[model samples]
Target: MPRGRGNRRQQDPIGGREQLPQWVRKEAQQPQRVVRNLRRRPPADADEEAPLEKRRRVDERQLVAMHPDVDFQKLLGGCDRLYKSKDLREPITIDILIRLNAALRHVCSSRYETIMFQTALNLAFAAFLRVSEFALSSNVIHEHVLHRRDVYIDHVKNQLFVTIKFSKTDQKGRSTTLVVDKNESNEICPLHSLKAFLQIRPGNDGPVLNKGL
Candidate 1:
């Protein structure tokens, strides 16, 4: 085991989702008819409730929720361009990832955030995971949230399997699995990075990517 003092990674771990309510379901679904009705009515200038961009994001979220496989993420990029509006996010171009890896090498912290997040970034890219798919949802329990038990790495086969307990796309809680296999590209190879991350054994229980010591 890697030698380090006790760290209070996440002072608490939720035991189950029954303890929490999924606000997204109620917030995101609006009977399509309601969506259409809302579109027909122009907002009053004095109402000033939510910004147009906020509405745009909700619309985009609906699109992604409905057609999870159509590369709506890319389509949303076009929306930003045509609307002459910009999303704060940018695509992970080759140059940016390279620069990110270089920077990760120099991050100094008590919780091993540098190594932890760097490995996670590599894994997320290889696994094509949405952050929400693995990250903790407020008030969610460990059974529904990710734990160290969820990751399985086959060093001999150079593969990894991550059990995704829940996803917006997988509403049935069927525990969708994500695979990360060795790729020809060494610079961005997730398998190798994950191997390195495992060597540290972040802990057997706790959020895989912890925020602090």
Candidate 2:
């Protein structure tokens, strides 16, 4: 019995239990820390998007004014040639052209004539010169304006010819040569000449050339 009691006392264990108290005491003694982080603001570019986007959109007048290369005076000058001699000399200026354009706009039947004036100022003078070949159409006087190439073409060929496209017929995918030559060499008819001249005229108030004008 004494030996049994002595063995029981020796086998008793409290080492593992002692660790729990140490762990609890360490946890209670530790201080809690509060951490703070600074967040960066969003990029400054995001705030500027509205005004930047607004500036990208332009109105009609703004767009027109933006085209610095277009000459309104020269265009008016070309169109001025379509009128009678006395009227044609009225100075091929933008002011006169705008007035004439405005006046022509009122006449429904005169739509194409207004277009012719616009074309003179907007298109190359060589193009407007083609109108003279057609008798039915008003004569585009040489003094007001003349396209360089068209005049060159006339000088080179010694015949009147105008630049025009002919996709409807055999000249199929390419620009068809219209003969304005009085010599009747492969040139286009009077109607075609008129059509070609009118087709290339400028629709807006723009500059072209003063050539003879």
What would the TM-scores of all predictions be?
Answer: 0.52, 0.20
Name model 1 segments beyond 4 Å from true. Answer: 1-84, 137-142, 185-187, 211-213
Q: Which candidate's TM-score is highest?
A: 1
**What tens digits encode model 2's per-residue C-alpha lDDT throughout 38-81?**
37433445445666666667764675688767775677688887
Error of 2 at 39 (Å): 99
lDDT to native, each model:
0.68, 0.41
Best by lDDT: 1
How many pairs collide in each candidate, listed in order? 1, 16
Q: lDDT of candidate 1 vs native?
A: 0.68
* Model 1: per-residue Cα lDDT over 113-152, one tens digit each: 6666777777777777777765666755556665677888
- Per-residue lDDT for 213 in model 2? 16
Give residue 136's error in model 1 in angstroms.
3.1
